[model samples]
Target chain A: MSNTSAPNKDLPGTILAFIFIGVGCLAWWDTFDMGDSDSYVFPRAVIVTLIVCCLLLIGRNIIWGGGKNHKPLDGSAWRRIGLVLAMLGTALLMPVFGFIIVGMVLFGVLIIIAMFEPWTRKLAIAYPLIGATIVISFYLLFAVLLNVTLPTGSLFD
Target chain B: MENPISYFFMSWSDPYLLLMTAAGTFAGVYVGAIPGLSVTMAVSILISFTFSWDTNEALALMVGVYMGGVYGGSRTAILLNIPCAPSAIATAIDGYPLAKRGEAGTAIGVATVMSFIGGLVGILVLAVAAPLVSEFALMFAPRDYLLLAVIGILLVGSLSGESLAKGVFAGALGVIIGMVGLDPLTAEGRFTFDSITMMGGIHYVTAMIGFFGVAEALAQLHHLETPAIKQKLERITPKWSVVKRYIPLSIRTSFIGVFIGALPGTGGDIAALMAYDHAKRSVKDPSRKFGEGAMEGLVAPESANNAAVGGAYIPMLTLGIPGDAVTAVFIGALYIHGLNPGPMLMIETPHLFWFTVGALMLANVFMLIFGLTGVRLFIKLVECPRAILVPLILILSVVGTYAIQNNVVDVYWMLGFGIFGYFLKIYGYQVGPVILGVILGPLMDVSYRRAIISTRESFGDFMLEMVTNPISALLSAALVFLVVSQTPMYKRWTNKRRSV
Candidate 1:
């Protein structure tokens, strides 16, 4: 996390992968019924390969030891990261907040932050409202009109 | 081949089929011209709608979309700097420059004619060479396929933006990512630790949307204030004399496109780039304005990319192996319609082959009609503010990814990869190799495993076979030559010789 050290960017990605791999190994070991031609055989092999790859990646990172110089994470990098987090947050809340509301809110926030358009009287207030309307129309078209079921929030029920 | 006149008359006799071709062509052009919407996406969406329709009708629609989509990408490449699909990346290099010179109409006209010509050539090859080529393809064992996949990975090194090492690293990373989900040979979950969702593996389409579409949008966000494109439609028509000048180049590039396209795993994007590179090297005096706004530049990639479409189908129709993702989806449609694409297909269903050829010809004619009229409307789209367009594109990407299986999890996966893709881009890693890896990784895995198993787990035998086989040895030699020629030592030595 130290900015001066030039964080190994691949470290974060690698660690996240390790977690997934570990969880997968545990799951495969615990519940996988290895009954001759059980479906778990495929999953188990995949997990083992993943674990091997993950360990190799971790070892490679250690041996290389930040050999290639990377630019320190600047404020802009942080902002981009924040935007990613925000998008993920919205996705997480989508089923809870309904597709229309979450989509509109996310769209408005992203446009404002990413586009850097001035929040003039007609722009900020109007854009988010319009985004909401358009998204609702799309929902109706796909879900109601076209008979495709979109995630309706618990509140709607 | 099979009484061309009789085939022509048979196609002409079917009025409904003709109408369907016209509709598909029109729809393909429109969908393809739209930025962020690719031919693959358009065809895939059409597949769902055509699920209930008869095979012939479905084929007409899919083929129309396929032809249109391939040609359609050129429109955006010319009018806007953005390519509608990966194949159009080469098209944009020359096409955009011509558009910038205020000859948008002329460029579109030339592209239309060339696309039609290219489509016709591809169809001709598909009709004549498919049977012969398919036999050759079947002779390729798993080891040959594994070598082919490695060659594809090497393309990542060539395509990686600045640093060869970085590109190789990205490619390796992609291969690793691709290894996630289930293993083909052992059916083992290679990377998916335990989550049921992870066990299914990441869908290549979702990764593609994330890496290309979402990553592109995020990158565009960094330069939102760039000047809006000003398109002028004056003097749009190509002079007959000018068109005649490029006929030789167009025809040659078309041959290149079809041949490359016919090769499994290669598609129009690579064909167009290779054609452009070859044209650049081969032409002695390629007009002073080649890259800046050369007509030959526009003609070469356009002709080749469209021709590659036909080339791609050669493998699909004859061997049940897709030349590209679009054709892969087409293979699914073929399966749905109770037709299996293999050697037996030619023997059992000759009519289907003829119908497909007829469809390709009709699609080309329709491309000309749609291309000319649609250019004006498409130019207008470039003027739309990015603020409005970007959000819409995101919605489309989300919906399109989800529509693949109507699964929300896919959408989340797309968004996750999109974020990861953006970081990769900022670090100067090219997305092309990552995509190529994702596309070719499974083939590499399956083929390598099969080769190993077939050789009785003898690693030495498998290695020997790769080196001993004529085609594999040749491919390996080419790959070695490519890598060696690109090295720093070679460049330095060449420079020293030149100084002498």
Candidate 2:
């Protein structure tokens, strides 16, 4: 390792500050179109405060160093990527494959990526059974008891 | 007035409500013990299912979950070294080490009994203080309320994050999001962006689910492979000697819990941490060295966090401000049930006040019953792999968000927020402030506008009124103090004083 003392946190911090600055500028400009003063007053006040806070963040990062020193995360990066994709994919596919179908697919993808154990005959039988039970129980609770209409997919329609 | 005694025993007398309370507490134990599951998330989701319930039934169940969940977190903190909630983070310091020494059962039992004691203290405080506070709150002007909302957001922001700026940033972002849709005063669009869909604005429940439920699940994805630790069990109950020995310490910390918990926007997690700090400084001797399995470690945090549940209700019931995130969700549930929670809540629905106290007392009792028993079953459930739990949480978040308004658009908004929230968390920003901002943002806007209108929109008069009014002046000073304390000059001054 070159040196643990210095990590390039300023790059991310500065970039985040600029991002908020951009949001602040855009919001300020958007306020021009509001016909009434009262409609934009609170938002304009909030926008200004936000911009100042971002500037302060930049100053603090320069003087005192990065705030909370949390490492991005450990373990497999592939798992995080898969987990995000599985969830986002579930949302995208929910309207197409239906809630149950997409949910099970998400569960299948998650199980494969999340598993750290050596695949065994017992786990093969157990994992599927357990996942099915969890999904079905939630379905009954939400659909039957709570009366939420789970999407049956556009294909069925 | 009409004999509050009958209402006091409402949950205990009614069979269905009694069952709901018991069942809620039982479920709450598992929810709190399970890593990644939170009382906030559970209460938010449960609102969807309980929407059609009688107001009493819903209140009973939510209180049961709230009381039980606060105590349940100590379980995994003792066994697995993984605190399921922020409130139990302190518990794990002493709890897991004790478990390593084959004293897991004792630590858990002590935590349970202390938690029960702390909970009773919180309830007693709430019963006495809320009525008085509500009466006091009736005198608040719009300017005072505006200042209050500002202070509440700043307080939450100041304490939650590593840096005050980042905390303020998140809160401001939430306020912006909340400012979307119809301007209630002018009945004109604020941040609608010309989309008809934006007219209704984003629901705070959607924000709650996205930030807490889905984001937490995604965050836990990074630790899915972490193995579970086995716990050793012995005498499931502690001796009277041990319990009696910790009573003074428990009571002292329980008071700390109530005081911190009653503060708007702070809650049990902060209370537990402060109590643990006090125990470390106050106790000269221990059953073992602190963080090396000291009994005092478990007792202090467990007592304080439970007491905080009662403390948290004070502001929510009296002033319509959330003392913490769980109470924030409770406020949302109250609104959905057509009940407005504020200073007038006590006067308008006195029965509701007595019933809530009764229900909380019932929940506290149920928490003890469920906390002491079912160790084996709980351990097995806790052993469930993270691979399954994370996915289930996501699904639940989806169903819950969609159920709120039966809108697919809300689900999309929820998922968008979840993804955005994940990045915010990784970068070390606290989402608690953001949620607090959303909860208080609308109230802040209305109060500010009303105050401004009172002054005929004269900015100077508004500023002058802030200083002239006693309540407003006091609140403004507190806000100034909170902000000033975060400045480098103040930090340097404090350091210099301590060095002398």
Candidate 3:
């Protein structure tokens, strides 16, 4: 219950609280401008409740150092960030380069970053084969079997 | 009308239906094993393709996937401590530990058999009690439905690891996400901020895939180099003695699943959590400590969650209401096929009802057969080096989100939420309540608004009616009790009394 420890552990909680509070405020502001009271009622109620919950979270962390010493964000977490960026990049590139080509590129990049191992002879051969197999299988399953119209990539066309 | 007996055996008689069912179950295992790909995502995608197919064939395959998916989630939970679905959360408590002790095969085999029994229990209840339960379901009003959502939200207590405040914040955030887009009734934007994409609202399935699948993959990165726990392959199936020992426990937990799954806005996730808590409290002494690989711990939740599958279908088939998220998608499939699913559905298309029940029985058998045989192979999957699995999971998440509506924006939302969910998980803030909130938020909003609107939008009148209506009054009382019992004051008072 003491707040004597270093505050590094509660950093995430504090940040989350601030984000929630900000989102709640922005939502409340939008609700006020929506014109129709009927349309805004549910959101208004929910935002008010959300703001209160955010405040409580902030108060708990400040008063009792709650969520302290929890898995503090470390440099290693950047690996995860890299993975997310790669996927996001894939999404952006898929329409331009097609899902298959972009997917394989991102898959290979992500594997290297995630595994922390340089490409070996075995991986060099296996990675492309596996990546190609996965990409094409997804294409066939969605595009051919399910008949979904997947993005063909403007470049490919 | 055709004889009900023939309708029940329709899948057995039709080779195509049988094939679809088996294939669906097989696909479901791998899908459920994968962190990001969900049964809901699979079924939602299937709906697009199956729209042109016969209703029976679509339902047959979907039932297979649904049954297999629920059971499949425990696979990752046991082996990797990453639950593929929210319903498998409790399974990881004991399951992962068992795996650490090289008992992954036995743990999964036990989970599979228990899941089969639970599925059978749920189906039997659905067949025998659908009409009776549906009749009872008809008695619920909008206010009662709102109360049900409230009760469902309160179950976030079970999901919150160590902090109720954090859970509340997470859950409230989910509700806020669910509140985006146009108001359901008025069609006016509430939090869209004038963007076209924002007006469409965030899909809970998208939120779920982000939270459970993508977030989980990121979390796994923290332990990327942690060597895989090698599993013991001997005695994959439990002895008949072990099976007999857990039968009573499975039965009790399955009942819990059926009842919760039958309720609107609740499903296997809630049922499984409740059953796990019950197992912890009821078992005098488990095979191991509850969170330390207890067989009772594994059995209780595995059976209950699968049983809840049957429970979920009851309301979908008998009443018009969806029992859970997947059932909500099932209802959409029904409407797409030009069939109404409600009280009248039983009277008009009884064949559909029997067909669903029969398909469920067949799927359960397939789940058992497939579940038992794949132990050695699945362990290899679990042992697959993290370097390869993590990236593949990320790709699957993106693909699954894209397949949802073929929209790039949803893919963005999925990644954004995935990052957010990762931070929340690391900070000990549960992402489960947030997803639960997204799912139940709309239900709560619509029910609350409709209830008040029916009373002329008078808050006092709504309060008066809540107490006057017998069904609403009962639900209101239960909600009050649930909230009070979860409070610190109540815990202190009970503890003090117990000490004397």
Q: If scored against the real structure, what TM-score would every candidate get?
A: 0.77, 0.74, 0.87
Q: What's the lDDT for candidate 1? A: 0.69
| Model 3 regions lying over 4 Å from their true place | A1-11, A71-78, A117-119, B1-21, B27-62, B73-104, B264-266, B273-298, B315-355, B465-471, B492-500
Give the number of the best model, judged by TM-score. 3
Docking outcome class, model 1: incorrect
lDDT of 1 by residue, A84-120 (tens): 6656766677668777777787777666655545558
Candidate 1 lDDT tens digits, B163-188: 44444545555665676776665566
Candidates' DockQ values?
0.15, 0.59, 0.58
Q: Write the per-residue lDDT of candidate 3 for residues A1-157, one digit (tens) a residue.
A: 4444444337677887898889888988898767876677777887877788778877867886665576344448578768888978988998899888888888788777777566699988997678778878887877786665667899878
After superposing candidate 1, which stretches have Cα over 4 Å from the reference?
A1-82, A115-157, B1-4, B30-55, B72-114, B232-250, B263-305, B315-349, B495-500
TM-score (0 to 1) for chain A, all models? 0.61, 0.85, 0.85
For TM-score, candidate 1 versus 3, the one ahead is 3
Pairs that collide, model 3: none
